[model samples]
Target: MTRPRRRVKLARIVNERKRKAALKRRKKALIKSLNTICVLCGAEACMVICDRTNNQGTHNKMVWPSKEQAEAMMSRFKSLPQEQREKKAVSNEMFLQSLLAKKSKKLESLRAKNNQMEMEEILHNFAIDPTSIEPATGKLTRLFLYINDLIAKIEENESMSQSATNVNLV
Candidate 1:
């Protein structure tokens, strides 16, 4: 079984050396992930990372898979309209924020669906035996309401179909 991932708290490392080491390690992992996705999906992608913190000022930027290919990709990107470029461009902070927003939205949706899913399970138990499960009064009411709503919808659909068939026959 796959182990649950440990959540890494996003915080700045106080120690400069450790911070630098972490940056290098994370950067390598990011590049690997990009390469893996590109190769797996057969995507044409150009990535440019500039390391201003590099000890050697001579080679501060790295481009993949090749400098020539990266330049060509960049040229195509530059040819796009300003609005198009702006729309596609996302800062690191913006990316994290948008990602967090999406996850939060999904989490809310899941939480909302939890009750419906639980009601379904309860209904399943009731199908086997009405006395199989003893839910709280409030829960039972909710379950009954859910069942009633479903039955009403089904009945409405059946009536509509019957009317349609009657009209066709006439």
Candidate 2:
């Protein structure tokens, strides 16, 4: 008979091998699922589903009749595999556009920062003493600053919206 220590070592090795094999099987299963195989019964050529219903052939089949039943089924499950999630397969055009939109947002923010800095420099250069303040001149400058700030905000929002637009990434 094997020594206890040797038997324990052998068991650990066997368990490790089983774990590795199971992981490999799981990877293959996920790949197969992404290719439209059903998760429940491993049925290929079946309806693509966000999550598989009980061992039923119809992948998207609901176990319960009403919303409560559906919610209960979903809540009972701990989690679904990433492949089983309803993630829209990534699209090339959307990916590229999102990349460009991110770039545009960065550029826009940089430009706004530079503009604000320049305005601050100009304001500092055209400094007026508070003690000798001209009411009319101060009011006119305040009005111009408010308008410029509003225009900047509008431009900022437009650039921000561009990023949102390319998100067909679902």
Quick one: best lDDT, which candidate?
A: 1
Model 2: runs farther than 4 Å from truth?
1-86, 128-143, 146-170
For candidate 1, the clash count comes to 0
Report the C-alpha lDDT of model 1 over 43-152, residue by residue, as the tens digit: 88978887655565565877878899998988998999999989968999999999999999999999869977999998888889998766656768888799898899
> Candidate 2, after superposition: displacement of residue 157 in Å?
19
Q: Which stretches of candidate 1 lie over 4 Å from their true place?
A: 1-5, 53-59, 80-154, 160-170
Location of the lowest summed lDDT over 10 successive residues in candidate 1? 50-59
Total backbone clashes of model 2?
Answer: 0
* Model 2: per-residue Cα lDDT over 10-92, one tens digit each: 33334666766854675566655554534575632322224334376654532223456456656544276666653665679
Each candidate's number of clashing pairs is 0, 0
